[model samples]
Target: MSDTGTPRMKRPSLHEEIVAEVRRMIVDGELAPGEWIAEMQLCGDLGISRTPLREALKVLASEELVLLEQNRGTRVAPITFDAMLAQFEFMEALQMFAGRLAAERASEDELERLNAMHREMIRLHETGDRSAYFSLNQEVHTLIASAARNPPLFSVHEASAGKIRRARYQANLSYDRWAESLQEHGEFVAALTARDGQRAGELLSDHLRRTGIAVCSALKAFEDAGERAPDDRKGRAR
Candidate 1:
């Protein structure tokens, strides 16, 4: 089974690769909000067959990063600062609940892991490495959620958090803001270690709510700089 007189090669799953690449494209703002994506073009762009490309599209749709239509193909879900605000309200409650549950249930090892992530986050923030800090941001939330020892809660939290990648990155514009956020995260882990449910919940809520405000501020600043995004009136409702 040779092609071109050489051994046939196996490749990593194209669907996963394509989906990851497309997701990165979306997150980096290369694929702007409300912009339609063409199956043929994406296949061509990635030099993959249509089958895997379609599979990747389905995966992206499930993640709510892209919306699919039977006839017109797919487009990115529109983003709105208003949605960011609403998400903040919902996420504040979700994370606070998660924190409370974690305080009630977290094992010693899990609590240590949570504290370890916070320390690493603090270190990353100190390096002023925005990209590294972003990755650590994800690790922090995930660690807390897993520590809660509730699969349903963890799944819901992950789904909600997954949908807001852009908003979080946009929030990191002000250097002081990120420092304050790291400080808050450290306080959260401390509260968790003490098994202080109420205090942990408060810190978690304040963290997400502040992140929402930060993203909104970033949006406003971008608009002020002549970067015009749709007014969200015509965009996705949430």
Candidate 2:
């Protein structure tokens, strides 16, 4: 193929790979919130030098996934209850808007794709594959956002979505909550499939609100049981 006709594919750079790995570690709870990040240990584990690792850390820091301290060292950004609630509140608005637009503008193919993903998500949930289910769950939401046909809105929603990914995963930690969330998704999909913009928006907003309350309650329970340190609940990390 001619140079103009052939697409140039660039593999992910080492720094980008490291950034994604570390971000996944944080989101998957492999690195807990408020826990110190041991630079040397992480370097040894990833088989990488400090330069690329630090570069990756800088990117993650910008994403608010990790905190870089001057002397105290880096730590995973803490997810305080208040911060979680605030994020959910912000996301509620975004998702509601997206849902309404998606319902009105989504193509038939987009709706079919969503239905396929939802079916697989249900299967994953049935098999108790929480991890896979969560991944598909995020994709389902993303598809809806994209279907809205609003670039600016989708961009903002995606950025904010990354920030609260861990919390969204945590929402399904409880079996009851997981089931309830699944049912909510069923209703949401139905509304979107029927092109009921108002109903879809309301359902999505309500889902986010409920998710926020559940996560806050779970955090409070953890605090009460001393699972999380008292200081962790004081304030959110910047």
Candidate 3:
């Protein structure tokens, strides 16, 4: 996190604000992966006590953003590139099934909901809002999961979303890519409308796997630019 903390008015509980800022720091690469976040120093810098800081740390720890060893204190958990690749694989299978289920069960209302989200996502593309676009990208996936009406599928998708959001935001920076993703969603919608389960499944799985490749490419570019991730880059998502 920045030495000066969030750098805004801090009238809230202080803990929440600090946690949000620190989380953003990790998400935006300000706090490098695997770096230890010293509670004492952070408390001193933010002019807060240990109570709030520890609470904030526990929250992050639960989210797997950081690891708390028995007595070694907290360090940012390494983002395993392989684990991320594995997530993409799981996402492929999960979303394919979701697509098939959606094809079978989607009502007019459900299709309209997905379509409305796609329209808003398109608007985000025009405005060049990468973050917003990724958020909607997440919503669309989760909506499909929910529409599948399978609690287990919904749980698994929700669990993976935090990691997926990071990868998506890191990769889909260009406006052209956002437009392309919108078009992909359009294809998904078309399949759903046509009641084509197998085709929809293929499209959904391909969409996720391709997006994983995009993010992996971006990660490789970062490493080539003379930076290091706390994660391994040992394989191709292709």
Candidate 4:
């Protein structure tokens, strides 16, 4: 221990690091959906052993990010427009509920935090930092959910958020759509600031619905361009 330290913080385990890396790869499309997850390749790239990599795969499997099979080993989970819409349906409901509850119950401090997160997101958007803006956009939603002060609701919201995260990431790839989304977010914040629970809920529902539409549009654009995701491969077990 250092002289002034009470205790040294433990570092993330190798398995945890592997899991985080794999998750990022999947979300960033480095490991595209329905692609074979080559354990050996990943182990080499990440400079880790098969043991930890397998362990990390187990964690991702539990999160529905990857699929494990007895004969097929593992593959990135298949993504479909229908599936994306389904996940967004649940996310919309959950987030709308969260916005309503937050508007009604949020403490002054929580409201301030939400405002600060929105400001940061706007700043990143203006600078054309899409990745950073998206990151903070997620945080703003999470903080809004937590501000509801309902533990059970927050738990459910977090699970749904995880499932739809990748599709949501793809949704903002178009510049015009991204700008429109920022405007929607601004309206949401304004509703919350006014403590208008009904308006906030309505705004949140519309925002998430629009996001799903944008994601679908992006998927169609990719299809039209003949850019196929790994999931399109036929005769392969998903």
Q: TM-score rank, highest first?
A: 2, 4, 1, 3
Between candidates 2 and 3, the one scoring higher on lDDT is 2
TM-score of each model, paired residue for residue: 0.77, 0.84, 0.71, 0.80
Give stretches of model 2 more than 4 Å off. Answer: 1-11, 168-172, 229-238
Q: Which consecutive 10 residues in model 4 have the weakest lDDT in total?
A: 229-238
lDDT of 3 by residue, 29-108 (tens): 55556788788987897788888888888987887777888878888766555667887888888889999998888888
**Among all windows of ten consecutive residues in candidate 1, which has the lowest summed lDDT?**
229-238
Worst 10 residues of 2 by lDDT: 229-238
* Global Cα lDDT for candidate 3: 0.72
For residues 33-134, could you state the per-residue lDDT of candidate 2 as single tens digits? 889998899999999999889999889899888999997889998877787878889989998999999999999999999888889878977887776777
lDDT (Cα, tens digit) per residue for candidate 1, span 97-201: 999999999999888888887777777776666676677677778888988889998988876776676555444346677777788888888999999999999
Residue 114 miss distance in model 3 (angstroms): 0.7
lDDT of 3 at 86: 81
Model 3: per-residue Cα lDDT at residue 106: 81
**RMSD in angstroms between candidate 4 and the native structure over all alpha carbons:** 6.0
Work out candidate 2's RMSD over C-alphas.
Answer: 4.9
